[model samples]
Target: MSTFQTPQYTIVELLNKAQCGELQLPDFQRPYRWDDERIRSLLVTILRGHPMGVIMTLKTGGHNVRFKPRPITGIGHEGLKEPELLLLDGQQRTTSMVQALTGDGVVDTEDARHHKLRRRYFVDVVKALGDVREQEDAVVSLPDSGIVTGNIGRDVVLDVTTEEKQHAAGLMPATVLFDSARCFAWMMGYQQGAPERMAVTQQFLSTVAQSVQTYKVPAIELDKDISKDAVATVFEKVNTGGLRLDVFELLTATFAGDGAYFKETGEDFRLAEDWARTEEVLHKHPVLKEMRSTDFLMAVSVLITLSKRRTALAAGKTGKQVPQTSARREDILSMSLDDYRTWAPQLRDALPRVARHLRDLHIHESRGIPYSSQVVSLMIVTTLLGERAEEHAVRARLNQWFWCGVLGELYGSTITTQLAKDAEQLPDWSLAKSSTTPEAIIRASFAESRLGSLRSRQSAAYKGVYALIMAQQTPVKDWMLDQKLDFQSYDELQVDIHHVFPKKWCEDNAIEYWRRESIINKTPLAKKTNIRLRGDSPAVYIDRLDAKGLSAEQVDAQIATHAIDPAFLRAGDFDGYFQDRRRRLVDLIESAMGKSVVRDWNVDSESTDAPANFNEPAASTGGVSIGGEPTPDRTL
Candidate 1:
């Protein structure tokens, strides 16, 4: 292998050669995610002639690399052939420069299906140039050309091809990312267009070109000693205190580190001021978004695939060599993206079967695992069965796999071996499990367990677990779609989870915790009624309505079946009618599970579940609990 030397490369010359396709990005590169503020800041720095870093690239074998365009629109080059040039170290600055100085912006991408690819847009270079100048220069007419430049808002034309000077404003003839080669100085600073600054910028460019003669770029060479894991560590170290680029950022550079960038990988190259829209394609995909459920885990998983073939954590990180990491990279790129397009049919078919299996199963806690085991299972199931998880038959496979993990015993969940066991047994199990609903599978998983974890639905323990479990994917709509939970097709009427005992009222009565927030106490009601009843005491609310129209008895009757018509709107007398409702809920909970919880309190008795969180009678006044503080009671 040749040792890396500081080769002389002028900024303009490098960019021009790159325009013919020299610099490239690897497949792991993500689209731009910076918002406008950051983009403007970078452009200002460059336009002011601050030296941006060198455009670094690793030398590689003569094999041509593919170069995908940063998701941008307009007159930029859309594709470049191999040996592709990967953007290393200076992506942010480069992208900002291209987007702001050039009028080229990523408008919309079109897939082969001709579906208008929804892309995030970026500020054209004209806007960026406008941002750096004094405010007065923003609207100033330029020198007989549409080009707007600013030292202090003066305008200059870099290129003018249109017939009319005024009509040219629409063109804003400047170099964007696509046509950047003509106007860029990648390793140098930008030449500002304000009349005085233009002279200075031109001087700066010339000086930069001369400096390349001995420009010692303090650089590390990409070599066999640098494995993917090694590269990841290096990245983590560099970003200890600063804002860290995510794992994908590191992994992309590693793959393209040998200076091979792929043009079709769809990296976000600052097409929009809103950086989140950078990778509109990846973020919009149901599968990619769904897989992104848990950021840390998903981050590692994506990089693992990209770094080298799908490594199963078994490959010890001690390889300490380049070829091995490169082989792994090949495996990552080897995984067929074609699998993504076919995901809907495959995964969608599996979710319902998995949902049915989990719909009624009683999971237990209090023994093998502490309290809050149910949520762990819930998160895992949701992930494996959530909208995107259904891709590639993830649900049916996960359904079968989960059953296998639990079939060993009731408290059979082992984070370590669960995925493996399921993976091992699933091929045959999926056949029988998908076609046949395994009632035994649920019992097989939780029989010896207490099932107490299932009872504390509204506890903080449950909420924390839930928050940790979800992947926290963005564009929440994509996730909902993956879960098949889109409620749009349903009627105007909707079901809302409402507090049956009127939490605020319970607080006043000192039994707030159990009665107010217990998942057991939550019920479905019409959306409007839920809002109207927000915190009204259910008993008093019903009693007040009696004067208007509804008899307390009639309200009680209606509530008994979990149905309510808001005929007594705003009357606020819903509580006198709750004793029967509480009883119904208890009965319903037991009925739903074919078992009973040891709830001894009566709905009519003033004695309540206030003591559930250990609050005694002394603390029960003024809506306070034991210790003269509010306690979370489990009964009402």
Candidate 2:
């Protein structure tokens, strides 16, 4: 049965009473979460006579929650207490009306998170201040810094002439909903969200904010007598965020729904908050951002695992709850959250050849996991494989399937497993068949918007980098994979990408010419040497080939295969570097495609040049490298 409560009240009346501090929130709640335009808009909607929704609350008869209405306009949020009333939904709309009509307190809406993402339920002080009296030197002038905690991140003191209604409350859009003292209001006249493309008129909007103009469910009263888990079940089905509520959230709601202290701000919220901070870091990184949210989630999983805090989120009230701190926060919020960033340093110190081994998955796409999930799965797998392992490279791709399969088996994981299953359906011998390909991901990523717009989190340009990597690596794995020279395992392999002119060096000299992800900067080398010698120019790198027991000629020949410019290498820059490499890799890919045939080169075989008949380049030039012109495929 539905626990939804159906009730209605004037937003203006709620706001008027709330401003006088007649409303308060349950002790189990957190502070006001909604931001500026959101709260102001509620007032406008109510003034416009727009139909708002009803509010729902749980009935707790002295279990432990005691809340006195504060002079706060919107609902207040404090820690949870036992046997208290809990708001199940309609929080924003109701609180908004309370803030607007009440003179007791004002809601703060400064949208300061990350970068001014105006959270709903926040107040607009500039507008609210107009109703106050100007006792300060004729008129109160706000200082440069007047925003308080929980307010959007605006840097202005909101001192206003306490005489005008406009100054009394910030001008807000028409869609905000506020939870007020014993009342709430929003555009509830229509049912569900109207699809009129914000059809609310500008005139009405000037008065009532442009909020969702619909009258959906009013409210539902929750019986305290019922089990909290049952109440949680009702909430899980009722609250929004259409995507499934994360595992912990569901568990928390169900497990503690009836406790007066369980309504809000529990272990799950803390975990999500921590995850969000980490998500902030990953979104900024080139590698992590290239992966999907699932992949990012995996990274978080890996971090949590490595941190030995795996159970922190789901841990119920254990004294060792997840530590919330700014320093830990930096792990996710301030830096690049890439494999290179975390494992890079570790890999550099422990296994210099990490990049070569890492890219093996790209050569042959593995199925059964989404790329993001795989990344997480891979991190865990890699952790399981141990660090400083030079020979574990080949298993990199293999472990992806193994460990991920186990995760699926245990958690009933769907997304990652579905991705794996989906990859098998792709064309044969394609790069995506081995590991997830950038192209496959991109096409799938924006099956909706090819031009750009990866998501609200990452940018269009960033997605391009991932797409580019996939294009170069995955499409021609049969031919490309062979470049490693025929060994089942990455360690047994004779050749790997050797930066002929180390990228770090090239970057210094030819800053403008060096391609960010150039194919030329890469060449085949032995597993051992690539790690020992990093960022060396072609000449220096060739000289150091002995560390891997390779002769100078072989090293030079290996570098030649990539055909990067020696002059560019010498100058360390190639304005034409990327374009040239793009042409070469594309040409190579095309030649591989045309060949109805593919053969692995034996690195150890002391074979002479191919017979004249076999030396001819293969059949079709399948892909067009993004160079100035399309060149014919030339297979080595």
Candidate 3:
């Protein structure tokens, strides 16, 4: 039962079908990923009358299921009924054509991912075909601000302040060539005064029109009876678009092939729709809002893996051993379209509950979560355990898991295996009321060497330290306002990573880059405070604050809350201050984790000696006592 029609379509006919709602994209196809370079290269090929590529479509209006037809380029229309064809492949080509011919952008209201294509595109006819024709010269997509005429030249320009004088220049809206009348009106608008130029321009445009009219795209039409799985296979075999289809995308196409749509609501099996809905759900919770669709999918995979294993164990199935980590990842990769469809609903319901559980453990927001792997295991554990998730024993083991995962950098690489191991242990561990403390699990890796070289923010250990800093509510507020540092209000507050010892000050004092740029030196403060603190040393800034009526009590509170040693506020003593503060910060981190996990107290300074001029003695060494010690005031 071969059910396919091979056809060749000119650009004109292809666009007309799109305009009449006869051509539609399947729900699972990813949104347009082509950048301006790819789009322009496509236009160059089309202008030269070259075969763009094959478009794959599925026929509709038979006994087979079908997706609701949609206009190719514009916003959605309620007027569209059923489409005669559902695009299985070639969405990128169709979308580019629609934008080039109709001047409408391919809107993306369904995918949560950011899109690069949004504005209408125009072609520079002169540049597209000059003495030296290059792909870059063919077409220019406009920015959000639209076209600017004055800046036009070799390539696309942004502003159009110089209007009619440049009209002698050949700039044509990509859509104008589609219709004779619109094309004529456009030519007349620019060709009014210069009749000779108009004739020349008209001839050039005419050639373009002919090129567009005659350009052929090969297409294969699948019969309505084609199975969704077969459609996925075909796309995998023949897809020419730059990004190869991942399994998620393949399953999406498979489901769309099934044409599972709600008859009353007109909703279809668009995986993007489900992904977008999951994003919406995550957005309602402060901690999960920043998660991507891939993250959500991974959480679902963990849930599926664990639930299956637990069920098998309970049923006394002796032969089915748990898959290895790489094999577990493969299991997720090979998940069937039907399985994805079945599990998506459960994922949507379970994810929020998981996020709530994370919040109880002081992972206040997305920034506080160290890795995506941690989110997967936790999401599954919380989902499977439900009300028992908050039980004393479950909480203790989960806490151990959290700190151990963070400190050990458990999810840094080959995360699937680690997640599988955690998932396998969680059901039993939660029920047993006992598990190894996070400190004990990662005890071998804990050392003074690890603490001395506090790595970049990307390191899990650094993020672990940061999580503790955040959990302790370090009294560094936004530079501009009185609001305490909070990740939940991040949108409204322009908080920035600030240096406790300003970088410029270190540079001015000839400090080495490593010591100046250490993670231990950075803290989160509002943007305004960072600017205000600019090049001042701690002593100068603290003095300025004191004069601004920063009470003695307030200064003491800031030092203790932020784990800053009194020596840090003094001038010079850079090595000693770093050492003192590093120990203090490590202690604070250990306190938050409820374990004596910090094994290092030495500062890993590249050079131990400070500049001779920088080591000035303090004017007054006595001040307010903080955390039971008298503060030292050094010379600025």
Q: Which prediction has the highest TM-score against the true structure? A: 3
Question: Model 2 over residues 1-636: C-alpha lDDT tens digits?
Answer: 654345543444434333333333433333455655455445434443455555666665533222221223343434323333445456566655454333333434454352333232223422322232311111111211333333455543343223232223332222233332121222222211444413432223333232223223345666645544454455456555233332234322332333323344442223344446545554443234333332333334334333333345456534556532111212322222232235433322322132234344232112112223334334433443454233444343343332223212221223333332322322221223354432222222111111111111122122222222333432322112224332244346443444545657766675423132333344544565566567765445545553456554444444444444444443434445544554554344323222111223222343421233122123223211111111122010
lDDT of 1 by residue, 539-622 (tens): 455454455465656554444334232333233433433333344434433333333435655444454423343221132222
lDDT of 3 by residue, 267-287 (tens): 446777778888788888867
Best-first order by lDDT: 3, 2, 1
Which ten contiguous residues of candidate 3 have the minimum total lDDT?
A: 627-636
User: Which candidate number has the best lDDT?
Assistant: 3
- Per candidate, the number of residue pairs that clash is 59, 103, 9
**Against the unseen true structure, what C-alpha lDDT does each candidate score?**
0.35, 0.35, 0.61
Alpha-carbon TM-score of each model against the true structure: 0.44, 0.35, 0.59
User: Where does candidate 3 stray beyond 4 Å?
Assistant: 1-25, 30-253, 256-273, 320-346, 350-368, 391-393, 430-460, 473-496, 525-534, 547-554, 588-636
Quick one: ranking by TM-score, best first? 3, 1, 2
